[model samples]
Target: MTSASFHPTITLPASLCEQAAQHLEQAVQRAVDGAAAPWRAFRRAESSDYTLSVSVVEQAAASLLVLAAESAQSMRPSALRALISVALHLRDAADATRRPTFTTTLW
Candidate 1:
């Protein structure tokens, strides 16, 4: 095949996108100190001292979505943002509602 006929494209694969998201979440977790820092703390995954606050994992999940917008190679930022939002929301919803379907490993 001619080189011009099959030029490499710039679409971000789902796996790479997920890796970028996981990287961003790790950043937020550090930024939030696993949500246990001073002013940026988020509630723990299992804490009874607080009155049912949002989990740091949850906040990190949300922030990761926003962070995905800046983490991927795509046609537009909106596409990234939407992908992040949808993935996080779906995952979060599934976690909250106990409806997860797909399970996998991450590196």
Candidate 2:
């Protein structure tokens, strides 16, 4: 005899899904804005302040990313993976901005 496997599915209301999607979008936008704030500051900073600005920016971006990821996790499981992928891309872009070859690099 063979055993059958069972998988469970959840059905959320349309309103609930919409609300969740909105929340996720807001969280992601906040993360993006917060991450970019450091870069703006870095641009205005003097050459001697580059190290400090980069350090602060990196920390802020990391914190915002973590918060956004947590928010995504709290929402629909189906969206969590996609949200994480977006976050990873954002982080990669943020890291690239810190490099010497970055187009906006003032140093």
Candidate 3:
């Protein structure tokens, strides 16, 4: 768990990154719900047209890229979780499939 590790940040127009996470969670839940729609709560904060944080911007930018790249995508939580799981497993498989060269790790 070093600084280089992947810790995602998502900053939306209405609230902080955490708020965006919460909204995404709710949106996913909504996709599965046959029940009465829960009252969605979002605190509206003025979108700083000029507000700039490099990390937050980078995280949001990455998400935009993923979103833009995908077609007929599922924004649902379950789907996202499954996609992440599959990606992780596939990545592991690919790594395992590789011929280990001491070259990559060689001093």
Candidate 4:
């Protein structure tokens, strides 16, 4: 994982985090398996800030997908293990959210 953090100002639903992690992981795996390159799957996009310095909520919600295939192509067994570790960390973090339980009141 890159030092760049995905720290969103607002709490995102666990589902969205999970989906993002899944997409990133799948793309990385495909690249490693020679199915497709990272550049083909990940694209860059630009956004504009309509607000003047009020610190818009949207600014903090940016999702960054960075895949350095140049390095991954030559990754050794240790590197692969590290990659898997990162994926598991992301998955566990996504699942850290608490599930709500509802109780019914008998009339």
lDDT of each: 0.43, 0.45, 0.36, 0.36
Candidate 2: worst-modelled 10 consecutive residues by lDDT:
6-15
Model 2 vs. true fold: TM = 0.33
lDDT digits (tens) for residues 17-76 of candidate 2 = 333334334554666445444434333334333233334434444644565566764767
Clash totals in order: 0, 0, 0, 0
List the candidates ranked by lDDT, beginning with the highest. Answer: 2, 1, 3, 4
Q: How many clashes (backbone atoms < 3 Å, residues ≥3 apart in a chain or on different chains) does model 4 have?
A: 0
The model with the greatest lDDT is 2
Between candidates 2 and 3, the TM-score winner: 2
Model 3: worst 10 consecutive residues (lDDT sum): 34-43
Candidate 1 on 30-90: residue-level lDDT in tens? 4633322211332221132322222433544555554454457643777566556645653
Show the colliding residue pairs in model 4.
Answer: none
Return the top candidate by TM-score: 2
TM-scores for every candidate against the unseen true structure: 0.29, 0.33, 0.25, 0.29
- Two-way TM-score contest, 1 vs 3, winner: 1
